[model samples]
Target chain A: MLILNVILVIFLIICAVAVERTKDLLGAVIIFAAYSLIMAVLWLMLQAPDIALTEAAIGAGVTTILFIGVISRTRRMEK
Target chain B: MDDIIVKTITRLIVPFIQVYGIFVILHGHISPGGGFSGGAVLGSSMILFTLSFGLPMASRKIPHKVTSILETSGILWYIIIGLAGIYLGGKFLVNKEAGFFMGQAGELISAGIIPLLTLGIGIKVASTMITLFHTIIEED
Candidate 1:
């Protein structure tokens, strides 16, 4: 359990940095979605199922769609 | 976007997502999930549909006007229910003192006004998500 938590946290840090470092807006959004998924799973492990559910639905689901829509309206590659 | 396989899979899966969302909303009082989470789940299903089919078809199914009405009515319903407590000579949003029926613990029909409030919140949140997504997507 501790090892799993450590691995998730490490992945989360990597995703956070990669989202910022990525030059492509769409790739950043996708990475952010991955970050959210990992955070949701961590929330579940922490016994806050409600937060986990919200994180998955809003973070992984709707936010990704919204971000993609914005990217379509503007540009996919960051300046 | 125009793939037959994507459309077929979306059609097959959306119903289950919606059912699970409703289940989460309805069982909120006795379970881990509540209005916001369930409503997000419900709204995401519609979003998935929009992604699979085009925006035109999705908008036809859940029009902007319908979502607007739903958003307004959800809050209106919540306010009406809350005011019922005052009408019954108690504090605003009071449950037991408001004469609401509280059933057994962990039952579906228990929790008095909480379930009703959750329903209102669920409706509001779901409509809000749909409206926001539609507006963002449709902007020129």
Candidate 2:
């Protein structure tokens, strides 16, 4: 279990890096979704079912939707 | 000296930031964190995503009306669950006297209404937070 947690943490760090490296805004959005998915898994391992489900549904599901929506309306016209 | 380095760093890590947000949220019950902490993290994740994706793509995924429903539903669910405790045996949100196994420590159903209450709160907090975040950045 300890080792698993360590691996998970390390992987999460890597994902963080991936999120930062992406240039295209749309690509970054997809990577962010991956991050939310991992976090939901971590929550389940931490004995937080309520949190896990919420994260999965809202964090991954609704949140991703919202981000995409906002981005479409007001793009980075400056660039 | 600092601005270039900061932007470079943020660019590299921004894509995966939402994962960290979930990490904070899922680990809420045991540690000093929970739904609120996690929810905020999730909100930030979405904000950052919007910052990158632009409003058109963002709006295509999450419209304002959906967020409104999510926010209100969460509030209503929390209220209804809390009221259940009042009608059961104790005051509003008094879980121990509500309904559950009410026997043996560490039993699956022992905590009575606590689990249900937590579930409601978790949903309320998570959806509401997401809704608020969406509202702020949503396409008009």
Candidate 3:
């Protein structure tokens, strides 16, 4: 479990950096969704299933859809 | 966006996701998931349908007016349930002490007003997600 947690933390950091550095708004949004999914997993590992479920729904699910919609409406590539 | 595989898979899985969401909400008092999480799952399934089938077809399944009604009704349901407590000679939202049928501890129908409240919350949350998605996707 400790090793898994470590790996997940590393993956989360990578996703956050990728989201920050990516030039494409869509790609950044996708990465942000991935980061949320990993955070959900971390929450589950900590035995907070309720928080995990909420994170999965709001973070990875609804937020991702909203971001994608905004991207489609406004601009795909950052200036 | 309309890949045949995506459409087919979404059609196959949406029902299961919805059922699981309902199960979670119903068993909230006895289980890990509750109204908020279960409603989110249900809402996500709807959003997934929108993504796979496009806004037109998804809107046909649940139109704007219907979602509006649902959002309002969920809160009304909660208020009505709370009012039931007053009618029963107790404070708002009282449950077991107010003559509700509190079955066995872990039974599906146990927990009196909890399941009812969960249902209302689930409905409200699901509609909120749908409405937000539609509004964001709509015209600037």
Best model number under lDDT: 1
State each model's CA lDDT, in order.
0.93, 0.64, 0.92
**Residue range B58-122, candidate 3, lDDT tens digits:** 88999999999999999999999999988894789988779998889998988889999999999
Decoy 1 TM-score against native: 0.96
> Which residue pairs clash within candidate 3?
none
Query: How far off is residue A7 in model 1, in Å?
Result: 0.8
lDDT of 1 by residue, A6-53 (tens): 999999999999999999999999999999999999999999999999
* Candidate number of the best DockQ: 1
Docking class of 1: high
Error of 3 at A55 (Å): 1.4
Off by over 4 Å in 2: A1-79, B1-27, B101-140
Give the alpha carbon lDDT tens digit for every residue of B22-84 in model 1.
999999999999999999999998988988898899999999999999999999999999899
Model 3 chain A is weakest, by summed lDDT over 10 consecutive residues, at A66-75
Question: Candidate 1: DockQ?
Answer: 0.91
DockQ of 3: 0.83
Every candidate's TM-score, chain A alone: 0.98, 0.81, 0.96
